[model samples]
Target: MTNVAKARESAVAAETRVEKTVLKVLDRLHALNARLVALHGEIKAAQPVSSGSVCLELYPCGPGCAGCPHPRWVKYTWTVETPQKPSVLLSINLDAKERDPVLTLARSTPHYEKTAELIREAKSILLERKKILASIRSLRNSARL
Candidate 1:
């Protein structure tokens, strides 16, 4: 296969991975929302309770973080929501560790926030994949220039 084929394959794989991750993140958000909805019933009069932990942050590892020789870094963290307060980041690290329960979301961790973030990430990966695929197709369709 040519370099173009390799690029297409890699982009396709990356797109799949990003899509799957988005689903997982959305699921976590959904579960947290459900917990809060239930809590709201009993705590209708009590102060809102919330508790969730943050996993970690992502930082650029290379010069630009979006090209070859550079790696995009994601800081892993686990968060659990509390009674009324927002979820708190319990642990954080460079590597992703499934230490804490994810279903629990802190009330503070707004569902919109996580969903938006995941959507943005998924879109970005998909866009990159589209660009690569488009270029390959263009090359295949065009006559020798």
Candidate 2:
């Protein structure tokens, strides 16, 4: 084959390879977008009835303090945020109020944790999508197509 024909063949092969790569990148981008939508939906749907943090607090007393039998108690504080009301702090003492329903529900439910995990996953996926797009742009510029 002549030199000109050989160069044409090489260019056609490079173009074909670039086209294949672009298609694969597009497919990945579509999948990532679908996953992001699902994650956002689930995160939005999750509405915690009540959520709080529990901690054990020790009183300022000596080892032999006759004032109180127990110096340490579990303190439960909940922060509730909603469209109607935001940042409503609810305090519950498990040591004193053992029958508190909010603490009980919060202990048994993992809504907050799951929502946080979903959000993190969504963020990583978004970053990945952005990187993929940047790479695709570079590929196009390099290929001059």
Candidate 3:
């Protein structure tokens, strides 16, 4: 019932709350790190080809072609190497809408790119979470003083 006793009780409660919050943050960071590892493995397994890089290029109709039906066209090029054979360059233009063998890659390529983007976003979030946890720890330290 004394003033000093009440202040001590309140401080203890606040410390407990901060500790719980820190535990929650640590749990989330652990989960995120696991997800990051799994995503990396999936991306590696989903490699489009043994060895190749996908490229996207955009070409404008032209400076004078103001009324061109197709102002711009998208092209995807894949350079792959086959066993016991020279490297082959495969190219496809989206404007034509013609189906090509490489069209199959279109699906997987986007999935791969999207997963990569997700990984980047997750990494950024992980860094932010770490910063928040650090700040919380600093706050707790200052409170102890």
Q: Each candidate: what lDDT? A: 0.42, 0.57, 0.51
Residue-wise C-alpha lDDT for candidate 1, range 21-130, written one tens digit per residue: 76775565445434434432322222222223322132335663222211122222446567887755443432244332223334455453553344344335434544
Worst 10 residues of 2 by lDDT: 65-74
Please give the lDDT score for candidate 3.
Answer: 0.51
lDDT of 2: 0.57
Query: Cα lDDT for residue 137, model 1?
Result: 55
TM-score of 3: 0.46
Best model number under TM-score: 2
Query: Any idea how many clashes model 3 has?
Result: 0
Superposition error at 22 for model 3 (Å): 0.6
Off by over 4 Å in 1: 45-145
Sequence-dependent TM-score of model 1: 0.31
Runs with alpha carbons beyond 4 Å of true place in candidate 3:
52-145
- Candidate scoring better on TM-score of 1 and 3: 3
Global lDDT of model 1:
0.42
Which 10 consecutive positions of candidate 3 have the poorest summed lDDT? 65-74
